[model samples]
Target: MNQQALVDVAAVSAPCQGALHWVGMEQIALPLRVAGQTIAGRAAAGVNLVDPLARGIHMSRLYLALAGLDNQELSLVRVASVLETFLESHRELSNAAFLDLSGEALLNRPALISPLSGWKTYPFTLRCRRDEHGLQAILELTVGYSSTCPCSAALARQLIQQAFDERFTDTPVTHDGVREWLGGEQGIVATPHSQRSQAHLSIRLANGLDDLPLAAFVDRIESALGTALQTAVKRIDEQAFALANGQNLMFCEDAARRLHQALRGQAGIEGFRLRVVHAESLHAHDAVARSEWNWAGS
Candidate 1:
């Protein structure tokens, strides 16, 4: 069959004449480069309908243009090329192009104090646009961790001290006796509450940037928080994790501040924004906080 002989309704004029800001396909299943590796992902590809009288865009043109991403590592430069091809393919119908890619990346993480390591999945999205304002991109991802509430830790410690005072007021307190008591429920009556938490980060990249700093960002943020959630663990790893929680208890504010400072020191980007969420074990509601640096726009 002659492809051009088939009906092409998109070539016909629209009954109503008006410009549409965006028009194209969304949630297109595709393979994406994430953290320097290829992963199964979905992409939303579109372009602005600048020509008001045009019935619709050449949707096939845009879909075919996505072939540029195949086997290519995702980067701002690579995305710009595909977007440029969108405008070139629709030289008269469109002036702007947009692409959004979403995927989950699995990274191997070592246990806190054990030789065991396991895979951790980080969900991420990369949004790209080419318009009169020039090329723009935003990299966003979520990292999970554990947060021990500082207030809860303090209150639990106070209760333990009170219990000790009541029991040892007349008894001679020795190291062995204190150790035995601490190992029992009577001395360490209450325990602080902790919850699995997550941090959401969005970074605006410089136009000339070549690679996404996802792995680096994950490492820095996890280090700053000091209690990244573990994937596999032994009894020793669990003990080490407990020690870490006890030593680095924080509120939502502290987690956000730590991430803010950590992101401030990073490069290859113009600005960043972060949010930390603590799923509270003590209450039904979650604790959330947000922070940003130079996030207004470029």
Candidate 2:
């Protein structure tokens, strides 16, 4: 018997005619290389269908083109190439291509005052868009930290002072006695409220960058916050973290401002939008503040 040709429905004209802004696959499972490690990742790959009369662009071509990312380390420059391949394959059909790759980036972070360290995961998504203006990449990630409320700290201090005045009314001030009292629970009437906080950063990259700069950016943001959440700690490290929180009390506004300052002048970054969220311990709701630089107009 003679074989018949298979039909391609996607190649046929659509009864309803209009071009699509985005069309392809989402929630695709893929393995990605980040920081020299193979981390499981999910992706959404697509291209713009400029042909209003055509049914669709070649989706299989986009899926197959993603294979190029499997063997190589992920980076803006590298991803740009894959997008170029996507455009080349859909040369006559699509005028733009996009790839959105998401995964958790893991790095073993050392304790504040100990030899111990533990793995920390930063959830991140990288997006690459290629159009007539050329390729542009956007990196978004979340970094967790500890934020002690400044207002709470001030109120706690006032209560502590009131308690001290009442307790020391009759006793003469002595260094050892005062120190002992300060060490006791009665002397330290209250402590400031603190909560685990997160900074969500979306950064646009300048041209000619080779890597994503995830690790470096993580370190910088954590250092600027000064109270990054710790893992695998000794008693000494715990004490140090406590001290850090006490000394570095801030509101969401402070955190947002700090991140903005830290990200400024960072090499390879053109613009960014950052949001700091403080999950309020005293209230049921969260407090958020946002800031952007070189991004408002763009």
Candidate 3:
């Protein structure tokens, strides 16, 4: 059977010629290799329509450009190359390219005081822009940790002190007896409130880096927070975790400041902004604090 050939309208001239800043697809489902893990991701890929006389950009070309991500590990290098592919596919039609990939990355984490390990999922997004002049990439991810309110800790200590005074009003206070009392259930009459908190980090990476510093950043934040969420736990791990919480009490502002200071010392990051959200245990609303550094021009 013979069939008529369909005309390609996208190849024709526009009725009203006008340039478009960006022409592409958003939330395209894809599987990408990132940091040795295959992550299921959604990508937004596009380029500018520089040619005003052209009817439109070839959307299929932008879609095809995403195929490169499947083979290469997701990083600034991959982002730069894929963006270049987007512009090359629509050579005359585009001068600038943009790509955004969002997915969850899995990391295997060891328990604090046990010989067990488990996987933790971190939501991550990579965004990039490329043009004739230069290229830029940004990574955003979140870390979940525990935050014990400093004010709450102090109030709890005061209540314990009052309880101690009431219990031994007519007795002599000795260091051994006080230590015994602290080791007993009666010592901890009041406990401070702590809740699961999160730190969201957005960092601009230096150009031409070989790999994404995701693991390093996670380590940095977790170390600074000192009480990252664990997937598996034993009695020893729980006790160690309670000890860690006692040592690393912080407010939302402290969490933000710790991240800001730590990220500033990193080598591959040019700038960063961090938001710390403490899901308050004592109140109905969450406490949030934001900190940023070296992003004035960006």
User: Which prediction has the highest TM-score against the true structure?
Assistant: 2
- Report the Cα lDDT for candidate 3: 0.88
* Residue-level error in angstroms, candidate 2, position 264: 1.1
Could you tell me how far off, in angstroms, the CA of residue 240 lies in candidate 1 after the best superposition? 1.2
TM-score of each: 0.94, 0.96, 0.94
lDDT of 3 by residue, 1-298 (tens): 8899988988788999999998889989999776678889999988888899999888888898788888467777777877888887888788999999999888889999899999998899988889886898889999999999889999999999998998788879999989998889998899999999999999998877868888888998899889999878899999999999999999898889888888988888999988999999999999999989877876
Best by lDDT: 2
Superposed by TM-score, candidate 1 places the C-alpha of residue 48 at a distance from the truth, in angstroms, of 0.5
Model 2: which ten-residue window has the lowest total lDDT? 69-78
- How many residue pairs clash in all the candidates, one count each? 0, 0, 0
User: How many backbone clashes can be found in candidate 1?
Assistant: 0
lDDT tens per residue, model 1, 1-298? 6466777777889999999999999988888776667789888999999899999888888899999888577777778889999999988899999999888977889998889999888999989999999989998999999999999999999999999999899999999999999998798999999999999999898768877777888899899999999989999999999999998899999999999988888787689888899999999999999999999854
The lDDT of each candidate is: 0.89, 0.92, 0.88
Q: How accurate locally is residue 70 in candidate 2, as Cα lDDT from 0 to 100? A: 92
Assess candidate 3 and give its TM-score to the true structure: 0.94
